[model samples]
Target: MNNARTSWLSRSPYWVLSMILHVAILGWLIWYGPVRNIMLERGKPKREALIRGKELEKVIEQMQRSVAEELEDRVTLLKNGQDRMATNFDTLNAHFQPFEENQKATALMRFEKYAAALKADQESLMQVLVQAKATKNFDIASKAGQEKVPVMISALDEVRRGVLLLSSDETIAQMHALAETALFKVEKPLRDIGSLLGRHRRLEREIQESKAQVKLLGSAMQASRDEHERVKKAYDELAAKRKAVLDQMQALRKVKPRNNDAINEANEVFKKLNEQYKTDRKPLSDANRKARDNKYQFDRVNKRLDECVKAFNGLNIQTKLPEYLQLAIDNLAEASALETQVIEQVLAATKDQADESASEVPAS
Candidate 1:
């Protein structure tokens, strides 16, 4: 029976072919996982586009910091200038009382002596200031560079002035001479303040007008900054998109070299991506250029604002002016009081002399 079956199977070609096909299918199923894993090991994965970003310009940030520090410096310097002015005025203020005389010399001699002292003090103070100025490194914020010498050379100037004016019965004549020559010392500056106020009013009007331009520039600068940020974000996105396209091109080059249709398709896609990248760059460049131009205009406006502020601060009338005016008033009041005393003494002396002369006349 076995021999009969074997003969039958050998005679059936279609049955043998069908068995071989079934065996081939089973072998393929068993080896599928290993073949796929081996191929994956041999072939590298396609490139992945990494995410990207950008930051604002460091130069701009640094310039902002520098401007802030410079403003602080200006404030400190202005304060120092005011302080120095107060110090000099205070020194002169203290020395105005003139009762320091030994009372030995004649009135003219004392006057000449006081004048010499005044000359000496003026020369000494000028020399001190000049020497400080000639120094190698002069910092205007410092006392030395500001010519605020600690020496008391000018401390006796007002004292000398008082001595020369109030030394004797010729006090009225001396006062008239001083008024004609020195114009009461503070009167000239007081007179000049009105003219200065006229200038200030005009400058104030200009400053008000300029402020509008400054505000406009400020708005423009802010808009430019916002646009720059938007453009930078979009530019980063575009860079990411271009990188993705580049990765696809690399993968296509590796996998589709033998396929003309796939290669042509990939080339066409790459060309489109490049063209789109260039087209997108136009807006980015425009945004950047606008931001740059706005920054320059902003700087100019800020500089003008600084100039206005400086001009406003330069008003001498604003620097402890009331105190100076009060000082001048006090000096005038003291002189008037001294004049009353002089007139009273002169009248008393004349009356006593008249009574003695009448007695001597004896019945005339």
Candidate 2:
């Protein structure tokens, strides 16, 4: 009997039994008065419980929506920041654009030409180093040249900047020294040029001021002439009026008895006018003399400016300047020679590497 029970129990589906037990528990809870009494003691009405459940669902939904909106705002801010970064990168790229082509051409023509051969040698050296590592050949692994080759080549490849295999810090320092020397050589000449330019500018400004002064004086002279003509016209009109009054008086005396008081008053007025005219004439003469003096001064200043300009134009700095620049040129030539020496060394090393590789190939 025990054996039969074990076989049946072993064949039974535990999932169906668990479902039946769960249903029985649920039925007991629904009909159980004690469970309902407990809920009532807790002060929760059945109808209010349903309403609270709906309210809780709404609050959860509101929370979810707020979280979603916050996330979306954060994403929008990130996207805008990313766009600004890209714009900044473009602006920075534009700022450096002028030098890019020349740099690329120089690298490609000079450094890149040797890069491929150097890379091949570096790879071969790395393989040798790996083999040596297994054999515990620390001597070969410790070789500075062999160890540096692979890492240096890999670094150059990662950066995509062409290699100058033989160039060393000393060579770069030498070039810098040469450049400094050239700058030192030309410094004095450059300062002299700057000083001359300043003087030339000051002279130009003075000439311009002189021209303005001449123009002002010419205008003043014209104004003085106009005033003199106006004074002369006024005096002529007064004299003519005096002559007409006298003639009228003479004619009236013949027709009737003369008015002596009118004649005497007219005579006195004419005398006064004549004296005033004479007084004004001296100023006219003074103005004419002053205008002539201004013209003479203008001419003298203009002549002086012309001579200064001629002297400045005739002066030659070219012969002296070339001597200064020639020193710089010589320094540049020396730097170039040093670079050429490095390039020759790299070429020779590359040739030796090629020959070694060729010899290492097996006869097939």
Candidate 3:
């Protein structure tokens, strides 16, 4: 027995050493394997990140440059319009010179003052617009300046009509009528665009509100469903317990006759539990009704949101607005050109009349 025990002890050390070596190898693999992979990954060159960052910066710069160029182009177009209007005023001023010979000077002087004021207002608006564009905050400044443009145009229309009244030439009257008609036609589409913009804003707000209502109603519905499930589970558990009690009472009554009081008490408890279960049905029903009602409201809000989105998309202004604006520009240019021609014609007629009068006068 001692020889057997000594042989077992002699093998145990080898077994322990083998186990220790295996555990040490496992620990080393577990700890150092991931560290080696991480070191390798860290050693790899990060050229992609540097390249991507440079590309992103270039894209940002390009976007900024494009925005600046677009703003500058719009400003230049506005500036050209202002210059054209100024030229029209200059034409009116020249034509007024001969008209003033007949004491029709007050109207011309009033027009000149208004033109100067319009020019000053336009310059200030342009400066505000330029600064706003630089900061990417042109909402108020842009609208203010834009609103002023139409007012100035209306004033110009009045001045043009006033000048036309001073001239009696049929050709001048015809040209003025044509220019005024074209301008009126242009104004119609602009007013339509403004109305469409207002409607779009209102529809956007309605959609946002409807979406919020849908979210809130959905949450309420979920809560109601959860409460309904809880009430149903609790009632079911109580009913199950009452069933078990009734089963035990039946067995007890069959086995013993002296325990009638206990049986009666169990029956009473079962009756009460059955009544409680019946009462619990009302809460489950209420929860279900609440959930259904909330779901219905959520559906309604979702429908409203969908309708608003459809209306917003139907505006299609992105596709049609530029065309309308171009047409307006073309009409305005034609009107301005026609007005200039009428002014020149009126000036020539006035000059010719003065020459005829001078020729008919006797020498003093």
User: Which has the greatest lDDT?
Assistant: 3
TM-score of each: 0.37, 0.31, 0.57
Better of 2 and 3 by TM-score: 3
Clashes of 3: 0
Q: Mind giving the per-residue lDDT tens digits that candidate 2 earns over 1-364?
A: 9999998888788867999999999999888837424343565556744458889999999999999999999999999999999999988877886676566446555564544454454455445445544564434433533344345445334223332333334554454345334323323433443455456667778778877877887777677667767766776777777677667656656654677777677677767766766786776677667767766776777787787677666544445434433443343344334434544554565456557756895534
Off by over 4 Å in 1: 1-176, 182-187, 195-211, 303-319, 324-364
Which candidate model has the greater lDDT, 2 or 3? 3
Q: Write the per-residue lDDT of candidate 3 for residues 110-187, one digit (tens) a residue.
A: 555654554454455445444544564424343553575577567656556555645667777778778667655556
Give a tens-digit lDDT track for model 1, residues 1-364: 9999999988799888899999999989898846534444567789996544433466577889999999999999999999999888867755642332223224334444544554453344334334433552112212321232222224234333444444344654454344333324323333343355566777787788779888998899899989989988987887787777778767767873466677677778778877878888988899999999988988887788779878877865455344433443343344334433433443444456446756884332
Candidate 2 segments exceeding 4 Å error? 1-266, 269-319, 352-364
All candidates' lDDT scores? 0.57, 0.58, 0.70
How good is model 3 by TM-score?
0.57
lDDT of 3 at 269: 86
